[model samples]
Target chain A: MPEYASILFSEVLKILMLLVPVLVSVAMIVWLDRRVWAFVQKRRGPNVVGPFGLLQSLADALKYIFKEIIIPASSNKVIFILAPIITMTLALISWAVIPFSEDFVLADINVGILYLFAVSSLGVYGIIMGGWASNSKYPFLGAIRSAAQMVSYEVSIGIIIINVLLCVGSLNLSDIVKAQENVWYIIPLFPMFVIFFISALAETNRPPFDLPEAEAELVAGYQTEYSGMMYAMFWLGEYANILLMCALGSILFLGGWLSPINIFPFNVIPSPIWLILKILLLFILFALVKAIVPRYRYDQLMRLGWKVFLPLSLTWVVLTAGYLMYFDLLPGN
Target chain B: MIAHAVVFYIFSFIAIVSAIMVTTSRNTVHSVFFLILDFISISCLFIMIGAEFLGMIMLIVYVGAVAVLFLFVVMMLNVAQQKNEWFVASDSSSHIPIGLLVSLVIFSELLIVVGGWKYKAELQDSININLNLNLTNTQSLGNVIYTDYVHLFQLSGMVLLVAMIGAIVLTFRKRSGLKTQSYLRQISRERNEGVELIDVETKKGVKIDA
Candidate 1:
């Protein structure tokens, strides 16, 4: 029994280790987004808090912690509270299967991809419930729009994932990254790569696809009623998801943690540097799009998801299958 | 062993209570929230069963999509007021006959199915697949769907496509007096002519037109 206890304890510790970096990275991303936005507009962002705004996220955390939570008079109190927790928890839960380094994963289940996709899909509930429980029209409208957006884009996302699954033959994240060590899927599957990146942006509800929270329309969307720490939870969860998507894109297409700079003398810089660099590049791409593009209208966003991305991804899936079949390289064959 | 059993019992107890709350809650939104709790319990059960795929699907699909849809539609709907009749439908005289018939049918069906099932409870222990190392279920499911169930799958896709198109056609209406931007016309416009400058001076007594 003590032996079993020790095993469980180690597992818990492993999970906590993986979680710490992800949470910290999410905080860093918040700072990075603000800084990038400031730089684009030629203004200094968060310079007062700490050196180059390093401690800004910490100060914000403190602010959220100390602020009073306001529950609306007519709102369902229990659900209003539970909604943000659900969002935060679902967002964090996927970290269990995410491989931060080559062997540094909390859990390595066979269905890790499915697990990540599933948890991500489940995040909509938190938004919907937050909107419904607030008993506000704007939140309700935001919830409805977000739900439709999520479902529409999710199909394309699934197809893009299926494209990757075809090459790897396993749903494990570690295996997927390993399969790309020799040659990243991006070389052979560039079209699908583009589709996946765009679908991911939509899936995370980032700008210009962030119609759910369009201030001109929905007045802050599903999170209008959330304040203090609960509001912070949603914000953290959104950043965490962005980090997760960047990591996933790196793992799938960019050869995660594999050295793109292959000069022999500096090859010893550790694999995680390559991984971090790749993820950072993708993150910058996301921020660049936000800075450059205008917010899309709701109907236009839906058209892009369903009409453009879905068909493109589905075509890529069929093409991948055909290529694999021609080479007789498919699993089980 | 006792501690594990105790924890399981506690989780199961909470699950049952939450499920009861889901059905009985007066507030529709509250019911949906309880449903989410019920799904979390089922996910826990899936973790126990080593069927993480199905468990996560329950979370992603039922709790995430369907339940959210339910809550969204329910919250938006305005319910009519009516007198409370909580106990009127619960009288034994009104329920016993229907309850007996349901139990009898369910029991008989369970007996027949259980008797015919080839696999035994003991056999399942040795037949269990390792959750981490195995790669059989999802792959095989995909294989069969692509091969044997190809027609059915394609048919389902067509159905979904038709339904989606039908929805788009139904909801898409061209409003009167709404000017829409034309892609071709916009693209073909000469840049120099697209914008024209008009000069005018505005002053209370010295306004002039050019």
Candidate 2:
């Protein structure tokens, strides 16, 4: 193969390796989220599809394929169609920098964390576009709500990540995970971790911060106008985003692929499995919250993000930096 | 080198077209969306040139934040409804000439900067943007911003703080008749205050008022 063709072939293969599992796991995660929620609510989940309801997502995917796509007459035709595609694409692309294990990643850029942050921030555009294109009162309101909610929480998330970055002294995702070999950032940065987890929940618009799609109020929120595959795209994008946040949380706090104890038998398991388990742990929590918590009023959600998390995270950043400086424990670049 | 030029031109093309659309779009929302596209493409150009930190910051601050605010305001104000009238006749028509003059001044200033750079490409090293080839983009930026330009950076932060405070002061108001939730009061209230038992005689109900 020519140099460029070889590069292209390898890159395409890597993308497939990463994305195929991601798309498949999205299906699995949907099933897992439903099962967890059902367990929390004391109800049997979708056991009718396949053994242990494993093929439920496949059935759902087929249903979406067969269903009719309805475009509103007054809707912005181009953007309405583009919205879900953009959402799903952006969600998948953010995985490019997410270090699954030590050297296993699509693109191991130096500023990987920032790239993730940047991509996640752009996630709001899909919702905004979908809502705006729908040309309906409820969708517009939902989009506006989503924009404010995301923007407000992002500040705190950025600050909280700074606390981790300070310790790691590098922006590379692999370096961040490596720094936690001795002890996870969660031990020292417990408060920031909790705040980060909550912010992650809000960032992904999971309940109780899921006011954008509160169902009772906005009638499916931004998804109101979407039908068939378009609606399924939004659902897939959302779950992927949720999974991304879980991966991020695990990477930042729980030690990305590190075993619980650095001993024999415990360390025998592969790193990727550890990452998957940590992600599953976070996903279960996400689903449980969905089942257990009541939806927040829009005002309370804003108050929590801005009034509470922002100041708390900002102060924690200062405090952590101060502590590091005082102890002369600042990692050399 | 050929691939680099190709990618550069591609991103630059997108940035320029989106920049034009931002100004020419009839719908205010479309203008905002184009502005976001412009930001993204410009940031892509930045990243392609290895200024990854700057590129990501641009995306986060502008595409993610500023454009969203623009979209929110445009959507809420229903600016598209009056787009034709704004083009034809507007109460703020007098300000248009002044706006054009200010824009011309800024544009000329940018032109001068670019022209100077074109003549003196090596003049960059004398200034603060001394890039160390060994260090990563984020590290180099941190080194410069925190070491040599630390005071200036701190001052800029202070300026931002003051501006934020000033904006809050401008918007903050005390409304006499406005009803607002006092979370502290709500939480601290005694059970007796919230619930009361009153004796009722015959068919008459207890007075809930007072």
Which regions in candidate 2 have their CA more than 4 angstroms from the true location? B89-100, B118-122, B125-131
Give each model's clash number. 1, 0
Best by DockQ: 2
Q: Give the deviation of candidate 1 from the true structure as CA RMSD.
A: 5.0
Steric clash pairs (candidate 2) = none
Give residue B44's error in model 1 in angstroms: 3.9
lDDT of 2 by residue, B1-210 (tens): 888899899999999999999888888888888899899999998999778999999999998888888888888875655755566665659779999999999999999998998898667465576456788978878888999999999999999999999999999999899777889999999999898877889888676774
Compose the digit string of candidate 1's lDDT tens values, residues B115-159.
766555544555575444444566666767989999999999999
DockQ of 2: 0.86
**CAPRI band for model 1:** medium
- Evaluate all candidate structures by whole-model CA lDDT and list the values in order: 0.82, 0.92
